[model samples]
Target: KATVDFQPNYDGSQEEPTVLPSAFPNFLVNGGTGIAVGLATNLAPHNLGEVIDGICAQIDNPEITLPELMQLIKGPDFPVSCEIRGIRGIEEYFRTGRGSMRLRGKVEIEENENGKSLIVIREVPYGVNRAVLQERIAELVNEKILTGISGMRDLSDEETRIEIELKRDARPQVVVAQLFKLTSLETSFSVNMLAIHQNRPKQFSLKEAIDAYIEHRRDVIIRRTRFLLGKAEERAELLEAFLLALGHLDDFIKIIRDSKNRDEARERLGSYKFSTATAEKLGILIRSQAAVQGDRYVFSERQVNAILELRLYQLTGMEQDKVKGEYDGILIDIKDLLDILAREVRVLTIIKDELRVIRDKYATPRKCPILAEAGEIAMEDLIANDAMIVTLSHRGYVKRTPASEYRLQGRGGKGLKGMETRATGKDAPDDFIEHLFSVQAHDYLLFFTNTGRVYVERVFELPEGSRTAMGRSIKNVLDLKPEEKIAAMLRLERSTDENGHDNTFREGAGYVFFATRSGKVKKTSLNDFRNYRKAGLTAINLEEGNDLIGVNLTSGEDEIVLVTRDGMSIKFTEGVYKKPQGELAEGEEPVEEDSGEEDSADEEGRPQIRPQGRATAGVTGIRLRKDDYVVGMAIASEETMLLVASENGLGKRTSFSSYRALRRGGLGVKTLNVTDKTGKVVNAVAVTEQDELMLMTSTGQSIRIRVSEIRETGRVAQGVKLLTLKEGEKLQDISLVIPDGEDSPGDDTSVDASEGESGSVTEETTE
Candidate 1:
């Protein structure tokens, strides 16, 4: 009790404490539950150390705000090890002292030797009776309200282990959800921190609770100091009397020996007078006038009695010095105690010091975990946030590995063997890596088809496989026509707008760049294809004999590079591509005029490029020769290095600066000198120094080579050999994989390679 004030008990026979002074914020630290006339309180228990820290913060700075206190004290920490979902309710409770807290029972799914699943309940919400919850669950199952329960038994011993068995065919998740709906698997508790203040019950926010505790501590410290100060003053006065009598030991002994009894000795000492000379010799400073009579110091009755009571040993020189020292110390103590009463900061400092000691002794790690959001978490939230290298084989098998699997190397060095491609079926042509790139599991992968259709699938939905294992077939995850093939794939991040709503397809983000094998190029607004349909969406309109060869997302500032099978490449600014004057009518065809294989000098060899609608054919991007078609299309910039691979396993890296910009539909200059030995250009892509290219052959042989390993040569030069292929094995496709943590390069493409007679190149082949 802080004070001695007491009141009569209910029967008026006994007295009771009016209040209990708590050193810690017990209302928050130990929590309580009570109800009175039209009033109730239910406070959740918090960490003791945290509560004290909050109290100390308030004492240190009275102006400390709520959030500052919250830093020391997180949301309520429960004793039982169960999850407390979200902080919103906790925040509201602390701010207004009343809110509902969401709580979930802890459970673990286990399996025995027979692979039968067992649900083990480890903990339950506060105030929930385990026996009652088990009975309720059994009752629900008996009434068929909860399904999938084959048997339920309380296996709880020392810990809260309630074993729940499910039917062989029953889903545990479904059963658990039903239990939560009917039983006490999940529950909520209302927090109301109502306490008595000034004889009136009042609700207290977190800050107010801590402030009240600090204020109480302040009062207790002040009261305690006043009491200590009185004791120190009395002790100091006694020690002064002992020292005075010791200094006049001879005179004291004579006075006491001359007395007939103890009473006479005490009376004689009380009236004993000391001369001014004797007072100076004794080093005693008499501040009271009553003690000084006629310029001579006389002892008071209290001091005289204390001196008379002194033992004989106290008269020794050593004892006398010790008494003097103790008197000096007691005087200092009295001054300090009085200072505490005169100033509030000293009292606060003492309180803080004591609290720190308590906190250090009692602090413990929290048992309950606080989730970022409340309610049942989606499965995706439990998955690891890791970037993966997703590789799709030519036969449509897909797998992903952690992006850290491959280490980058310089150009032309034998790269790491990432995966084996020899598992192709007999009917499959070659198991070469077709689509290889890095993306997070949560990203969206949009697959573009040769027939101009687009399909969307989450990266996580794709089966995970090891580096050497063939993954699950893409057909299993995505529905496709018998002969349909995915021509291009793009990864898009899940984005949110200002309101925190998902905006997967934000207008004005960029355009979807598309290119066809017939030297056709098209650019459609990305917003036009945001609505994802289970069936698919029409990405582009292709001519009768044309197939979409490449797709990428790009801003208008990118450079367009189109490489033809005849070793010709055309470079132009992406913004120069035609823009649609107005939206096209449904089923309307874009402008189409067949450009002859040979140059028609009078026909203005350049295309009058203009943007068109999604359901329209694209304008010519490159004029091709007979039997020669566009093999690759890439979005490039000044910092990009164009890696073009030939069918004969030959490739070279040429900087984008080496190519001159031209209007679309122009007959391009030679990019590679395609002779009898080098074969036709198979793949051309924009790659950074850190990128690695995985090349696959028709015989299922593949090799990874760093872009920097390949020689950088002139546009018209025949490149060096990239891979040593077996007889009858032609290069199929090239997939550029960017290393993790590396900056993204420009758009890339997979081009086909051809096999021809090995011979030295004499002159460049061009239309």
Candidate 2:
């Protein structure tokens, strides 16, 4: 068992010091375990800042409810990611002031292209050994301790990937549901409340232990504060008494100065009789004859000097001045004392307020009295019937009966004596049984057989709505305060005969059920139907007469439904006929006959086509060619001659005299170019604004010239003439020729000479 102790002390200075001078308790955030006696506690640590704020909030206002605290605290701050179960109990424990920390994993869902989704876990809880945890899960599956987990095909130290493939027609949400329901990606911790004391043999909850310590400390502080206040008051009183004594001395001196002679002064002072010592000191100063006068007791210089020399207790005994000064100093000291007292009082007041809040916030309400018909049984009769009764209180105690008292009658009955015989010899078996039955601040009751089969009727007070249990009025039990119900229940019973060995009555199987408001019971089971795979009722068969429209299948459970366009339905089981892919058949097209003959030429000599041609392409003089280089040309001359050329002799030419003529011709040119090879000029007059020239060489090379940059050369070729043909002139078998003085055309400058001819140049240039 691990123990943590926080002992604080003051060094008479202002600072309080921590006693445990080693490692602090920060590891608790990650998760840790401790045990004391029969109880043990596990801590799942979270974020430090969050934990501190939670503690401070409780300190500020102890009455804050657990739900409210959870809102402020949010979830655990785990280093690794994980999920926490049983969080509903967390608040109750904290209010009871006995909760451990928790770390949870982070999980999210992502969608793939197929409309299928996968659950992705990005983090795990702290202190969970990656490799070992995975290995343990694998072992559990292999050993059949866990089942219905199919997709754990592989696992690494850090991650486990599950199988997520879905059928072609399957819904994606169903697959996601299965992944969460069937996997070990989620887990929980059950807190086993525990604490230890060096002087005691028992364990305690954290709240009980801390409350005891705080109360003890509060008492100590109150006692110390009262003692300090008493000391301060005593010193103040002594100073006030000294101040009064000083006032009497001042009165005696005034009387002596008014006397006429020493004799007169003596007689006057006697009327106000001072202390003997004070009277003597006054007489000696007044009796000096030379200083004495008739009305004011005045004397000569020598007489006054002699009077001043008279010893007044060596001048240190002139106590009036000393007392007066001391009184003023003491008054200042008292003021400081009062200030300290005021601050201490404020601190106590605050402490009281905080304590009151804590009491109101976390305190459990008294149990509501239940009005069930009382029943009893004799100890001997109960033992004869092999029955055991248990009771619990708000305090923590448990007791039960020894198995030896039961009369065994079944095949597996080696009798209650068997359990007693197997019991460890540490103490009498009966003592353990008695301890189990002794109630000590526990909130539940249990009744069972020696073999550990719980008698549900004997334990739970059935509500009026529970028809199965005789419809007993259990509303009072259900309404019992939060602190009244037990946290959990356990039972001991004889094992089944599956082993096929000698019949020996050991502890049998037990089941735990959670009570719900609707009178429904939830339980943990080895055969869980909630998981997608184990629930065998998958498909609902909806025939033509069946009324069910939709069937909700459990996750990972496949269902097939057959339906006609007219809405008849039928469901198929997994073993039944598989779904067949549906297809459509081809059909013939239909046509409509005209009601009357088509119209002839109208009075204006224009023919009109009937609606019969509506489905046909209506354009004229244009055809859809597989490969035509569509080009738009701007006219440079009054009429431009155009050529169309392509590979494999797919070429033709048409002539147009003007832009209007070209539009009417609707020529489809095969190629257009903006630049020529060797970047030289040829037939520059033919170039026009934005006109693209196309030329093809014999070796299949193509060149383009931009007509906008043309500079006309005033020359023409004789053999291969460059002529400016106009007004729809068309030429064939013509080639480009360079001037005589110019350099001979190289391979790079030679025209393709494939198309019929090239046009001539005009002696015109644009600025």
Candidate 3:
């Protein structure tokens, strides 16, 4: 009792315990943060089960290596729900006792009803104030350094949810990157594993920290067990005395009855003796050495006093039996306690068993996932690079369906419905697919917007959906201005594992060609867009009111053609060489300079669309008439024919060979005669016989037709009507997907700018 509290109160009247004997490792499980005279401790809290397991593993094998211990201990598991950036910092701290560990708050990207994105914070780094983090982010946004975020709301209650609303032009990835760089969403913990060991302050490695706990536990258990064993032995001795006295109850009663008063009775009972012959005859032996005389036993002073004070009911037969049972139980308990105190291993086992019990009852699994680096996901390597068909709706929804979902349709038939277009409500207009293309799951796509900024997306990163699903919104995925829409999209092949895997046509192998709605064109090397931050960079500088309409990836020597809704079309080359003075453009071969003017029939040709700077608006490819705009652009050989379709479903197939390759910015020849009955030409596509076509009407009706069904005709001929429409319905869009045979994207064929990549011209541009 005197040792229990060694410290005296200020009044010197009371004592308090200075050292607490906690059964668990408080230092490790609870951790600590404090400043000392010359050093400071910034220890991270760990999971109780992990700490206990580490202690037990250590107790089992005292020489366990750090790595073996780490498998069980992992690292500090902060109570807050944030991820540790890597394991290297954990290893450093565990080995040398000091290191810097990075932690990032958890965030989820969600789309709002307004077709905007929200970065919802699921957690904040340990010890960071969510409100302060939000404020810091808001300040950054106000200062214009973090330009993407528009607003913020703190919805944190029991769980943290700091909702940051992104502007229509804000990229979620870029906004998140800015948050990490500028705010407390990401933080570093400087781990200093310092604590008290052996009655002195000391720094400890992982093994040493656990070892200290085990040693303290070992001492505590040993001392506690020793104290319990002493108690049990003392009680058993008294019980033995009581049993011996009960054995000779008649003599003890006689002696007590002969005495007059209690004092005299106690004295006389103390003097009373049982002869050895009598004891042996009674089948009793004394256990207390002080009470045993040479062949006889006499009651001691304390025993005699106990006998005088003993209640009469204790002498009853049932009472005496219960006393015997209790005494026997005590004897067993004493033996066990003695055994435990005798062996050091027994105490260690007891500690381990107790730790395991606590662990079994209180442990929880880790909440935070550890990663190799910030923002890097390791699962991409496991995703198969299967081909997928991606579609974008006019209302900004995007989804990827497997290419196998689409089956080939026979010629001149009503097309199968690929999607059920139920919008948000009845008041909302039904949406139709504006863009459709096929790409490998691992490929990268460059999205050029009407506002001239470019962004990128991995094909696999898109949400996969059923063929009949509505798909996710593009506004929820990419950062775009509210008024800006996708102008042109191009597929760039990038190996997901390029450094480790051998791949042909390294990323950025070709050139990106761009055409504007205002009859302008430009070509830039594809490699220029290979690297960019998530917010993206400017792909082209647009003149006011001159929006980008189309873009394609070219081989730097492909033939380029532009078609207008007014039925005028022109074809040119992308390469630059000497022109024939009057011969502004020519055929597939290199152009030869001619001295004579008006020399029109040159077999040789030069590239027309020169590669321009990334920020430059290009030269004109066609001269548009009033109220006329480019509807489609194609790259094809003169052997193919242009199939022009109008709003009334009237179409014409004109041979490309008949149209002369003129100077890039010329008034193109009429490909079809526009009449009131024929309506205006909506689009034109280069077609081969085996290719298929899909047409949509304003009433949401659609049909499929084969290109071969339309007979080839002269450039100025009015064509046949392909479909009959309802009273108010008109043609809305036209696109196509071909079977895997001749229409398959091969090395030699010209690519359709709309279908994307190096595929045969199978798409009539609607987007």
Best by TM-score: 1
Please write out the lDDT profile of model 2 over residues 539-614, one tens digit for every residue: 1121222121111111121222221211111122222222233331111111111212222212242312111111
Better structure of 2 and 3 per TM-score: 3
Ordered by TM-score, highest first, the candidates read: 1, 3, 2
Model 3's alpha-carbon lDDT is 0.71
TM-score head-to-head 1 vs 3, winner: 1
**lDDT value, candidate 2, whole model:** 0.30
Candidate 2 TM-score, true structure as reference? 0.26
lDDT of 1 by residue, 1-767 (tens): 23334789999999886667666667788898999989999998998888887888787788887666767777788888877776677778889999877788887666556666677789987778899999898888889876677787887887898989877766555566567667788888789999998678989988888777777778777877877877776676676667678877788899999999989999888877777567656645454435567788777788898887788776778887788778778767877887889987898899899888888988888777665352222223435657777777777877877765554432223334545665355696556677766688767788888788888877765778876677866655566654677878888776777976657678887778888898888777778877776467888887678887778777756778999898888776555333334543222223323344232212433333444567877777777778989888888876778888888777788888777665566676678878767788887988888667767665554455567767677777777667665666567778776455643332233121222224322223331
lDDT of model 1, residue 700: 52
Better of 1 and 2 by TM-score: 1
Q: Write the per-residue lDDT of candidate 3 for residues 1-767, one digit (tens) a residue.
A: 12132577689899766566667778877889899799899988888988899899889999998877877887778888797886778888999899878899987788889978899999999999977887788788778898888888998899998888988877687778778878889999888998766558787998887777777677677777767766765565455556667887887788778879888887777677777666445433334445668877766676666667778898898987887788778767766777887888888899899999999998998766665462343323435677676777778778987765554443333344566542233357787666766677777777888889898887877879977778887866676656778766777665445455523235556788888888888888877775554666788999888877677878888777788877777777776533333432222223223323232223456456667668887777777879998887777675667788888766667677666665667666667667666678777777777666666666444455567766666666666555555565576666644443433222222222233222112322211
lDDT of 1: 0.72
TM per candidate? 0.60, 0.26, 0.52
Return the lDDT, model 2, position 623.
17
Question: What number of backbone clashes does candidate 2 have, counting pairs of residues 3 or more apart or in separate chains?
Answer: 50
Minimal lDDT window, size 10, model 3: 758-767
Q: RMSD to native for every prediction?
A: 10.7, 35.7, 13.5
Which residue window of length 10 is worst by lDDT in model 1?
746-755
